[model samples]
Target: MEINKKSQAGSLESSDLMVYVEPFNEIKIEVESSVSSQHTEEIRSLILNELEMRKINGVYVKIQDNGAMNLTIKARLKTALLRGAKNGN
Candidate 1:
């Protein structure tokens, strides 16, 4: 799926994550987390896995995490990707 414009999902509240996606020539990801020193790689892996599973590429993703768990992160990324796909269509 192609992200046509900026789209977002989730919240900045504790235990939640906000995900933003937009169209790009190549995939670019930026992540900010309350526990970046600990969970940054894990979080990036989760997001990349989700995108790969959906065959999504050529997009820019920005994640703002507030201590969210893995499941929450996956759900939020899926939500944002779906929303972005809809916008593209």
Candidate 2:
């Protein structure tokens, strides 16, 4: 789906995350995490994989992670994507 505007989900609480998404000319994901470099790369990889699976492009995503688990990240990403999509409520 095409991201029509900026949207966000989740929070900055420990063991949680905040996902922000907006329209862009390219796929850009920025992650802010206190985790190790390896884990940060893992987070980026996970978001990339999800966007690929959804065929989502030309959007910018920002993730503020507070030691969140994979499932929580995915959930927040999904919500942000939907909220940012043109057809989303």
Candidate 3:
């Protein structure tokens, strides 16, 4: 059976990021980093992976990272995806 994925709880710290995981949408990304390019890349990669894993396609993602760690970024992305998926955003 195809289980419907619902939006998960959002994190207050990563509340700034708005990621939409649905059909027919754009992938928008914006970063506010005091970190290095490599770190940013890592976070970006992780986000992409998370989206793919959730089987979500065609959506825009806006990330405003404030020197957050990799795990934190992932959590934020997950929350956004869950929210978007559940709310049909």
Candidate 4:
């Protein structure tokens, strides 16, 4: 599916996260984590898997991770993606 516009979910609160989704010509994923660099790759993989599972493409995903677990991040990503795709661009 294609993202129609900019959308976001989650927040920068402690032990939480924020996700931003926008329309783009290509899939772009950016991640910033407060935890540690060691978890970056894992988190990136998780985002990729989630996008792949949902067949989402041609969008930019910006993740600001504040020590959130995979489950939380996944939920946020799904919500943001859906919101971004809600209206036709």
Pick the TM-score winner.
2
The local distance difference test score of each candidate is 0.86, 0.93, 0.55, 0.88
lDDT tens digits, residue span 1-89, model 1: 77777789999999999999998888888999998766988898888888888888788999999999999999888888878885542
> Model 4: per-residue lDDT, tens digit, 1-89?
77888999999998889999998888899999999998878889999998898788788999999999889999999889888885523
- TM-score of every candidate relative to the true structure: 0.91, 0.96, 0.62, 0.92
**Candidate 3 per-residue C-alpha lDDT over 1-89 given as tens digits, one digit per residue, 9 for 90 to 100:** 11144333333353233333333344444444455677667767777687678766665565656566676677767666655664544
Window of ten residues with lowest summed lDDT in model 3: 1-10
Q: What TM-score does candidate 3 reach?
A: 0.62
Segments of candidate 3 deviating more than 4 angstroms? 1-28, 87-89
**What would the per-residue lDDT of candidate 2 be over residues 1-89, giving only the tens digit for each residue?**
78879999999899999999999999999999977778889999999999998888889999999999999999999999999998886
lDDT of 4 at 53: 85
lDDT of 2 at 60: 98
CA error at residue 89 for candidate 3, angstroms? 12
Best by lDDT: 2
Find the number of clashing residue pairs for candidate 4.
Answer: 0
Say what the RMSD of model 4 is: 2.1
Q: Looking at model 4, which ten-residue stretch has the lowest summed lDDT?
A: 80-89
For candidate 2, give the lDDT of residue 42.
Answer: 94
